[model samples]
Target: MKQYNIAIEGLDNGSFQQQGCDTVLRAALRAGIGFPYECNSGGCGSCKYEVVSGEVENLWPEAPAVTERDRRKGRLLACQCRATSDLVIRMRPQPEAVPVIAPRRMPARLLEVREVTHDLREFRFGTETPASFLPGQYAMFALPGVSSPRAYSMSNTASGGREWHVQVRRVPNGKATEVLFEKLRPGDELEIDGPYGLAYLREDAPRDIVCVAGGSGLAPMVSIARGASQAGLLKDRHLHFFYGARTPRDVCGESFLRELPEFGERIHYHPVVSMPGEGENAWRGETGFVHELLRRRMAERMSECEFYFAGPPPMTNALQEMLMLEHRVPFAQIHFDRFF
Candidate 1:
């Protein structure tokens, strides 16, 4: 078998590598390069990748993962391919490890609940057992009769690997938040499992940070900023956050915004509104798509910074594309969690 050197555009080092024209999606993962994917079956093209090098064997001839355009362009689903030869492929780059937590279902009592906005709430839970998690991780709150799992990010800093503060947005008809707002009371016993997702601040890589959050996506970012503020972990890096909301009432954790630098002297906060009221005439900020705002500004810093994104799936998708395509950020530098 002939061997060919594979060079990734932004990846600096190559260690254990996967070679072949059609290496399975699992192959890259096994090689220490984990690509975000779901439903590894061909039906879910999450493993979509483009071949940039040597040829590979196609194991699944009829694999539905390859699209007509993708196939034409030499893009193949990693799971459907079998390495016929040495190869180099291009797929979405992975982000710095943001801390994946194993959620434990524990009974918690509501210690305190604060209204960060008209509809946004920050609930602090004290469990009989220490609920440990990273700052930007999440917890799943399961209702008594409801089968769905509602994931909420911890808005507080990680401390002693115990306790957490979760931020929740009250959707108009959200079953979980509705129950939280209407049925739950402080000191009430609640089923909570938490410390999930990848949204933490990387301690080893001190690159400048740019965090964008929409609606409730601010939870994880808030947790991150709060963590930075408390211990100054992000002390040397320039940290900036862009939070977009409908109106002033949608803005939560204003205090953090007010005293950003006090946390590390390298942090800044910018809040924007898509639609403001006559009374909010004093509001001074850009107004439009958050991605557009990011595109227009932050061009120079895009290359040297790390981006953390959370919120609606559309927002994350748009931000991901904008950061990669427009802002020219390597996929590895962009971190995100999708709220579907």
Candidate 2:
């Protein structure tokens, strides 16, 4: 394997080595450079940068994060490009963007797979090294036969252990889910690189915590809630957990959260169904979307708490609009990594 030098145009210490076939963002992050990025899958456009004077190979030219205007401007997503030669690039670097735990590729073995819902499954993997990360950070898995890696949030609290768990929903005709659901089996081997994403539990904040999740987005929210319990944050502060699904069958989280040692009155679980079918007449919990439930239940104290949410773009976007635009919540108070 060969290495290429990556020099940032303006910063004095913005130099790092890009290992063979590694994306620019990964290399910078591995080198402890705080290059801005969120959703390392190239869906958020946060890792876009300019090629100052170097040759690079674009991995996903048609990535939704990169627009025609961005391509015309020669801006490339650092997570989607690899340096072909020694190169200089330019991107805004924020000190806070530095990863809490630097990511490195490691081998993991599938330990177990449990059914969570009709379309969702919980996967447990055992890594050769301890899988350490913040409670809400995500890991990128390199599945066999997949051209690009897929990101999944860790569902378990960080315990400096060798076990990792993620809940994945089967997407219709999704290449990654097809492999994850059909081909992979217990004892299978795969590569995982992560501890990425900026959305994690803020233990220092004195305010109550609110987590909104839908579909597969439940993974990180569960981790956040568990972490809060483990860290004793739930002892004094309330954690409002709102989860939404299409039908009663898709609803999960009660069993998962109840397994936590800190499950108590301080933690409130609100499960809602958006479109229950005719057969789901027995459904008696909250109805409508999760964001609507959040707004309805916590509308008065929206600004008094910290919000963390993840879901499909529509759900996340709706929550963002309602929280930031409607309720006047500060941008810093809400945390999430967009997953397209």
Candidate 3:
């Protein structure tokens, strides 16, 4: 039985003990150390880290985000690699560090659930203990009879209370969605854990912040934007939101977004539709994919602005590529959470 010390450098956050056989990221999470990551399956590059010291074995050789250049530079996807020895990895800052709170598990009871669109549902639940999380962070919930927990981002920031909210889409056979839409009822108890993710708004973000959200991805952006508005953070910073949907019927949370503009004219909103149905031609807003629309409008200043996005893999992946390769936006300036 061998355990290794995993030291994450450059943050006051110290080190943790990890089993030699487990991925560094997994061990970090299990150790309750807040680290940057999303799509822990290695589909997204959020967990890519430079191995400052020690060695690791690639547990998942087919990591899509790891490049040959990354390997040459000693970078590995933390989610796909297990530490072979005591390790020191230089990593990103923990988003919530004013005072960090480790992930916790608790019991939650379903309070209310309602359909928001043809495919989207809004759910309200109360945790057994009050929980606090960053605006764009998410929680993992294990429903009764389900073998695994499903992650859902909060639609609002942690209010330092027992209640929280999330928006879900009806995936044809998604375990949590099915349980939420078909079997779950108000007062059903479930196991919950987390407040995980790295796509949240940074306190030091530039004066101009751009958010692009597709489908239910708008949930977290709404949370960030609303939180900023409520805390008076938007007064000095410009907030621009691009929300996309497949059709008019798929749009959700218009009223919540509408209030953002009242924060000030600097708060802008773009609701784009990818496909407009018959008689929907009268719509005067942007069209096509959200990334394309953003490129058309902000291609000139993208390299200078900070960007955050949350959405389906296709949307987030394409947008990240477009911003980095085409717009020349710095990799460090773009943050994303890709929902699988």
Model 3, poorest ten-residue lDDT window? 93-102
RMSD of each: 9.6, 1.2, 5.1
**TM-score ranking from best to worst?**
2, 3, 1
Local error of candidate 1 at residue 154 (angstroms)? 0.7
In model 2, which regions exceed 4 Å deviation?
A: 279-282
**At residue 334, what lDDT does model 2 achieve?**
95
lDDT of 3 by residue, 128-201 (tens): 77877877778777777775467788887676778778888898977777888999999888877776776776
lDDT at residue 79 of model 2 (Cα atoms): 95
Best by lDDT: 2
Q: lDDT of each model, Cα atoms only? A: 0.67, 0.91, 0.77
Ten contiguous residues minimizing lDDT sum, candidate 1: 14-23
Query: Which residue segments of model 3 deviate by more than 4 Å?
Result: 1-27, 30-36, 45-100, 260-264, 280-284
Q: Give lDDT for model 2.
A: 0.91
lDDT of 2 at 67: 91
Candidate 3 structure, TM-score to reference: 0.77
* Candidate 1, superposed: residue stretches over 4 Å from native: 1-101, 257-264, 279-282
Cα lDDT of model 2 by residue, 1-340, tens digit: 9899999998898899999768999999999999999899989999999999979999889999989999899989999999999999988889989988898899999999999899999999999888888988999999999999889999997687898899999989999999989999999999998889899999998899999999899999999999998898987889988999988889998887897665668888899998766754757878898898998999999999999998999999999999989999999899999988
